[model samples]
Target: MSVWDSIVGQQAVVGQLQAIVSGDPKALAQSWLICGPPGSGRSNVARAFAAALESPDRGLSDEPTNITRQVLSGTHPDVTTLATNKVTIGIDDVRQLILTSEQMPSTAPWRIIIIEDVDRMLERTTNVLLKEIEEPSPHTIWLLCAPSAQDVLPTIRSRTRIVNLAVPSTKAVADYLMASVNPALPAERQFDRHVAVRAARLAEGHIGIAKLYASDTQVMSDRDELIVGLLGLRKASDAVLLADDLIDTAKSQAEADVNRQTAAAEADFRRINGLGEQDRIPPKLRGAYNAIAKKDEIKRRATRRSRDVLDRALNSAASIYRDIAVLQNNAEDAVGLINMENRTAIAELSARLSRQEVVDRLEAITVARKRLLGNGNPMLVFEALFCALIPGRL
Candidate 1:
């Protein structure tokens, strides 16, 4: 697809970028602060902009000399994209971009640099970038994507043009899904507009999760289990099981990552230092060495955050149950959960749990999330949390 066709429902962003690429992008439209909830089109917008800026001669191409395709493959000489993959984009990365931007593009129409998750950029790095943005090169355009404009520093926001992309309408999403799905599936196999809308709304503008729900029964079941587990009796067994599941997930990710890095580094080291009197120590081993050197912090953060993700799933379920508890009170009216299927247990809990008890437990779940982000103890926090939520054997 041409650059503009990729953004599903955002005509304005598409138009704005087209104009900019056609060399009439409004002078006022520098440094766009594209913000949206996670899974939204934030990164896509930045990518689209980069594609436009790096457009190769569309009508006439030299077989393989296309800048747009290059940018798409993440190999464009003049376009640099940074995301969470790099632990951090130091002042050096930004400074290098500044230097690259100053030099004329080797191939692309213009120099486009995309800083994804701009919020993750350290303050010092952000400061270094600000200098470049303040007086950017004529051929350079910086596209910054953040979860919220507020996520970027105040001073940084003040200097840039802001383009707020709204969540796609449900009708838009439903229509898009219809086009994306297979036609061979019977009409009865289709999702009604209502189901598509619910999935889209809950997804908060992420087409990926919306697609997951439509394509994977497992995803839907996972969501259901997550909600139900939270509201169910806080059994000691359930808490332990949940924590163990998370522990496995986190450990598996870390070990697999270490293994992949170790293998790649070892190969490169061996290739460079062939046979006689060569070094056996793989270069990639250096990274593993550094990681083990910081084992305390790495293990601490990963274990806690994984548990937090698990606990948050449980807490959401708990909230579902809590609402039902409130409902049994029947105070005037309640904003109810139409999706909540396990209402019987909710009603039973209402009779047993005091309002204060429900509220406090919810508060504890929130504390668990904070502690996880701050790198708290995984087992202790969740274990104690379960003890609080679960009724004790007196």
Candidate 2:
């Protein structure tokens, strides 16, 4: 299929990129910024745009060429991508990308650089990148992805053409989920239409999240448990216990993710060094391996992952309260509810608590999220949130 096929509910964006790819090469800007909400496929759009630019027929053909395939897989020689899991992108990383940007394209018509989460870079690092963007090489093209233009420095945003992508409609996302084959699943397996529709609704227009909710039964169960637990809370002790449980779960998930990533990195390092799975590293190579397995970076990544897990839980919690508020205001049918499966529980909670109490709990969730992001103690933050969520605690 065509490279753009993978992108869902973005026909206008595809059309814009297609026009640019088909237009005069000399008139194209050297840098572009792609802005969208989380799971809205900002990174996917960047890669698709890069593929189109490098495609033999300029992405007009029905099927992707080999160049398009390579670009999509991120194995193309002319494409450089930086997609980090860390809390921030360091200055050194930007410097390295700058060096890569100076080189001429080895094979393709343009040397493309795609940086996902550009907002993660601090001002100093962004300044380091600004010079290159301000005066990029003639054949170099930069594609930056962020949640919004406001996330990046004005100097950086001003130098590039901005493309904004909106959240897809619920029906659109549900249809895509039903039609798309998840590579992680068995070839013979497909998403049930009912499940896809529910996932799309729960995800609130986030395609990545909708896929997760559809494919992973555990995620859906955990969300259900959290909402149920919140509704069942009747005392401060219960709130404290749930907070501890949440923290422990977040930590366990983060640790597992870090261990997996470390194992994969080690395996890749061994393969690159011509060593087998059971092979021992030579003395000289041991230091290099140690450097690759820096403890600080691993710790930071784990912390970030833990925080991410908790943040998602908080978002889910907020959605539950939002649904309750909708029911309280008698707008359930008009605006619809995110967690339709939990409508019974939400409706009961709506009846138990005052409208003002629901508002207080929602505000508490917003504060908890902010404090969590600000490096506040997660346990305390969660405890406060849970306590506020207790019915009539306000």
Q: Who wins the TM-score comparison?
A: 2
Query: What's the lDDT of the predicted structure labeled candidate 2?
Result: 0.88
* Alpha-carbon lDDT, every model: 0.64, 0.88
lDDT of each residue in 1-394, candidate 1, tens digit only:
4755545567776776666666644553556678876666778778767766666543123343366677767887888886754445677777877787788777765677788888888898898888777777877778888888898999789888877777766556555665665343456556666666666544445676565455544445665665555456467888677555545644654454455555555565556656233455457555644554365755565554444345435544455545755575673154444344666766676677777777777777777777765657776666666556774421
What are the C-alpha RMSDs, in order, of all predicted structures? 7.8, 3.5
Total clashes for model 2: 0
* lDDT score for residue 99 of model 2: 95
Per-model TM-score versus the true fold? 0.67, 0.85
Worst 10 residues of 2 by lDDT: 181-190
Residue-wise C-alpha lDDT for candidate 2, range 1-394, written one tens digit per residue? 7888878888899899989999999999999999999988999999999999998888778878999999999999999999887679989999999999999999999999999999999999999999889889999999999999999999999999999998887888888887774545675545688888888888888898788778866666776777778878999999999899889878977887788789889999999999999998999899888866699988888998888779879988989888988998889889899988778888888889887887888889989988987789999999998998888778
Checking candidate 2 for backbone clashes, the offending pairs are none
Clashes of each: 3, 0
